[model samples]
Target chain A: MSSKYSNNLIKSADFIQSLERGLSVIQSFSTEHSTLTVSEAAAITNLSRPAIRRIFLTLESLGYLTSDNGRYALTAKVLSLGYAYLSSKNIWEIAHDPMDELVKQTGESTSISVLDHDEIVYVARIHTKRIMTMSLGVGSRLPAFATSMGQVLLAHLPSEELEEYFEQAILSSYTNHTITDKKQLIKQLEQIRKNGWSLAEQQFEEGLSSVAAPITNRNGEVIAAINISTHTGRNSRKEIKEKLIPLLLQTAQKISEDLARSPHPMNL
Target chain B: MSSKYSNNLIKSADFIQSLERGLSVIQSFSTEHSTLTVSEAAAITNLSRPAIRRIFLTLESLGYLTSDNGRYALTAKVLSLGYAYLSSKNIWEIAHDPMDELVKQTGESTSISVLDHDEIVYVARIHTKRIMTMSLGVGSRLPAFATSMGQVLLAHLPSEELEEYFEQAILSSYTNHTITDKKQLIKQLEQIRKNGWSLAEQQFEEGLSSVAAPITNRNGEVIAAINISTHTGRNSRKEIKEKLIPLLLQTAQKISEDLARSPHPMNL
Candidate 1:
């Protein structure tokens, strides 16, 4: 209790608030509301119209936002910030080479992704041409439960964290194969933890199946997950288990070893 | 001058110094100096130690900058800002299908890049197996002259703008084939404009070749450029010109057509 008082007494100035409010305004935007009138943004952030407009103008001048007619939208210049994170000599770069090797040997669409709140964001991908399918890339995010990468990453979390996740997340079915039940998902994660790998058949998208394994650090903690995606119609789960699993596991192990050796962070 | 003065300036109670100082600190940490001590940040931004310490702590709390072992660096959370931009319908969703189709047909690395000052930044890439040899993704930046996409995009600029660019850019040689001379680059851009596509052979990197065409809006002004990259050892310029030229040009045309067909920004 004394420590809490001391923490509050540490006058960090109003600097953090300004930064947070700026970011909060940015976070107000998403796939659903890509473009917003100034008034709408003000409503979303609970900031005054003048405050939001100032931030918007600053962002637009910096090339992170663009306006046409009356509405403002984000521009690709904003990617530079994320690129700074994803391109750091950290986890994504370490796992990339091994991912390439895995794709070479197995010819499967391999990717390394990390958990972001309730979503799974792909940070790297070694795409194979056998399947002409959905759009996926580094920086692409999807529902955590619907991805093989998500299950393996989720399996590593403590029970308390899992419960908190369930409390926050909505388990909407993306495909017929997607697990909608919260209890079933918890059980599946447990199985994934025991098996050291995860196979999600048509979970995220119909006819698109994937298998994933956790990439651990020196402390044996899961930092990220690596996966191979393919069409279920082209290959069976058994074939993936027998042929792709070992290679996938080896890639995961190689990435884990690399993580243990390197001093840089995986995602940061 | 009258129109410029007519532009509304929004006044916000938000602390502008806090935001500017924080961003300056983030921008200070580049690839060269990813880790900086508080003193280093203070020196870089010409802010006092107490002010910088507060800024760093605030940024760390917001997940933009992380402090550890007496050094500060950016975090993956900073990417959320950029991800918000890519989530916009104008760029990511609109360009996804065409990029995929371009990759399918060309069997080369296809990317959607936009101009950021004198350089071109990759906003998205639909990479083929062979092209996966390199690491380039959303936010990756490269000099415009050394890339086909850069050349095509530069071709879109007015002659005075091109001269100003040459004045500002260092024009260093990334490869032996890179155009270091300003006159030569201007001539090349002019050809790219006349022919409707640009080819870069061993320009950005030795043994890598690429072709790019511009994507324009209904106004016939280039808004972005799409490129196809491949290994120079695998194919000749003639092969790319004969095979990929048509595909690249058609893809750009398609994206432009889509942009044209879409409702005007004012309507939205």
Candidate 2:
């Protein structure tokens, strides 16, 4: 099989197509398609009916997927896989107190997110108030070009990887303020790198705004980004810059210092 | 391949062994073993080195696993699997406000947990005060017999299933107060079922006390349990029973009511 991801370097001999297919079957059950039939899963995964049937049976047998009548849905066992990743990273636990403190000080939702492909995945979050229309939570993903956390993380990426990302990204506009142009996004990223932070105003959603800073490891590599999200209606750009950004940066720095001091390595 | 779980009724012909093996590889990475070599993964999963190599490569290619030198670790992409399960159940979002309210009212940590085999996996949590030594988060698992949520969940299980659980359960003692005896546990479960709530005092961890109530679906079958956990040093048993339990039960009832009123089914 051909590699879909450009970063994948493993030889064909080492790759297992069946395992990937099985994971795809599990991924097929999302919010939109919570319960799926065998044929529905087959269609979603683009696998043969026999293949999807086997995958479903395998997942159901393992207790990750449960069958209700003719439809299949994921059970709580699937959470264990994500928990394994979250528990492995001491960063979430280390940043918890600091994130909470940031929320307390700013009275806004504070989150720590890591760069994954073209999106940023929130790993730790503490909400002081829910101001955004979108229901943001741990494990939620947002496009790297449209969100403050994503911009901070993208700003710190290796030059070649960033260039490749720019070459391949779709850059779809969510709002009129969103940077859909590659040249403009690159310029924004460069400015964010120089400023050591980012403030995105109504980029991803109509009234959503956030200020973010990179959280580095002991090696000073930006492993994740932390942000304070507020509403455009509640807080003006000037007020957010003056009040929230400093506290957000301070909390990010404290978390970075704590991460550096931690004996356990922050699993990126 | 033979089925490891008795409840798995799918024929061996339908079960995809490779899929099971692949999931096992993912499961092998935990808090203790965050990064694993091919040989280490092989040993943990009881699969051959070649099999582990293929699984690792497939996972890496899918962006779920990343390799550094000879060690493999999970990336943020893996969180999407857990997010799929979480997003499927709007209950977490629905319960968020009530849980926050409970935490505010009692000044304790509030959580919702669902039974996964012999363990209760925390699905949602809101911490007002950090009282426990153990760092508890969403997806953290605790023994079903030792935790208040676990007891409430176990109490609501059908008679045959509960009997089978008692028969197979190790019932290991976490603290001296933990009820490890089968007969005594059965009696306690009976009382919990009758009372519609449970209060576990220093059962799982010394000084860690919690009161839990079952959250049922429209069918009135106990799908999950919600609890308010406090420290024994902070509040007496009488105070918790009188004050926290009522609030806990009310929140659970409200959640249940909302769940019943919801158009979408709770995918348990």
What fraction of the reference interface contacts is present in each model, in order? 0.34, 0.56
lDDT of each candidate versus the true structure: 0.73, 0.81
For model 1, residues B1-268, the per-residue Cα lDDT tens digits are 0111122343444325566666667666655566778999888789999888887777766656655576877765666677676665466456768877888897777887887777888776666753353234667788887889989988988766776677777888988888999888888888889999998999889988888999887777787899888998777777887888988888889888887776534111
Q: How well is each residue in A1-268 modelled by candidate 1, as lDDT tens digits?
A: 0110012333555357776777777777776677887899999899989888778776655555677765887766666666656555465557768877887887778887777667887666666763322223556678888889999988887777777678888899888889999889989998999999999998888888889999887778787889998888677767888999999999899888887887653233
Model 1 chain A: ten consecutive residues of lowest lDDT: A1-10
CA error at residue B110 for candidate 1, angstroms: 2.9
Error of 2 at A48 (Å): 2.1
Clashing pairs in 1: A91-A266
- Model 1 C-alpha lDDT versus the unseen true structure: 0.73
In the range A36-141, model 2's lDDT, one tens digit per residue, is: 8899988888899998888888888888877767788888788888888877767566887887677778778777788877888887766664322112377788
> Could you tell me how far off, in angstroms, the CA of residue B174 lies in candidate 2 after the best superposition?
1.7
Flag regions of model 1 displaced more than 4 Å.
A1-15, A104-107, A130-136, A170-187, A201-209, A230-237, A265-268, B1-15, B24-51, B65-75, B92-107, B130-135, B175-177, B230-243, B263-268
Clashing pairs in 2: none
TM-score of candidate 2 relative to the true fold: 0.93
